[model samples]
Target: MLSLPATLTQDHARECLEQLTDGLQAEAAQVVVDAAELRQFDSSALAVLLALRRECARAGKHFAVQGLPQRLRDLATLYGIEGLLPAA
Candidate 1:
């Protein structure tokens, strides 16, 4: 599983995405991203999640998010992309 940082703002989004990009290459048939550690973040968090979701889909791997904070869920909902990050 890939863990998100406490702060996932524009300043860290790129690096976060890069890290997740590496995680996606794992040989597992599915990827579970644990988001409980994420406390401080911005819309860029959703961008990172979306990118991971897209990458997983392209690789034919199931993607799920675990321990998503309510605030981040709200952000995903606001962006109308919550469906893509199904709760694990």
Candidate 2:
């Protein structure tokens, strides 16, 4: 499982995506991201996850997020993207 940092805002979005992408390349057919540590975040967090999901799709790997904060999940719902970020 790949772990997200405690804070993931726009300021850290790019860096976080790069790091997670690198890790994703090393994962197996199914990639699971742990988002329990993510305490402070913004819409950028969802962007990063969406980008990661796209990467997973291109690589033919199944992608899911574990322990995503409720608030973030709600944000995804508001954006009509909750279906994109599957829960593990």
Candidate 3:
């Protein structure tokens, strides 16, 4: 499982995405990202999630996000990318 940090903003987006990408090599059909810890974040968090999902798809793995914060959900919805981040 890949866990999102509490504060995911532009400051940490690149590093966070890199960290999550490291887990994509796991030998599984589905990749699960836990987002319950996410609290202080911005739209950059959504971008990180989407990037992870894309990487998973390219690896022929299913991507799922767990415990996504409501704010992030609203952000996704606002950006019209909610469908891209499947709930786990």
TM-score of each: 0.94, 0.98, 0.96
Best by TM-score: 2
lDDT per residue as tens, model 1, 1-88: 8889888999999999999989789748888999999999998999999998889989999999999999989888888888988987
Model 2, TM vs. native: 0.98
Could you give candidate 2's per-residue lDDT for residues 34-60 as a string of tens digits? 999999999999999999999999999
| Per-residue alpha-carbon lDDT of candidate 3 for residues 1-88, written as tens digits (9 for 90 to 100) | 8899989999999999998899788649989999999989988999899888889989999999999999889989998999999899
Deviating ranges (above 4 Å) for candidate 3: none
Worst 10 residues of 3 by lDDT: 19-28
Candidate 3, pairs of clashing residues: none
lDDT of each: 0.89, 0.97, 0.91
What are the runs in model 2 whose C-alpha is more than 4 Å off? none
RMSD of each: 1.0, 0.5, 0.8
Which candidate would rank higher by lDDT, 1 or 2? 2
Instruction: Report how far residue 87 has shifted in candidate 3, in Å.
Output: 0.6
Error of 3 at 86 (Å): 0.9
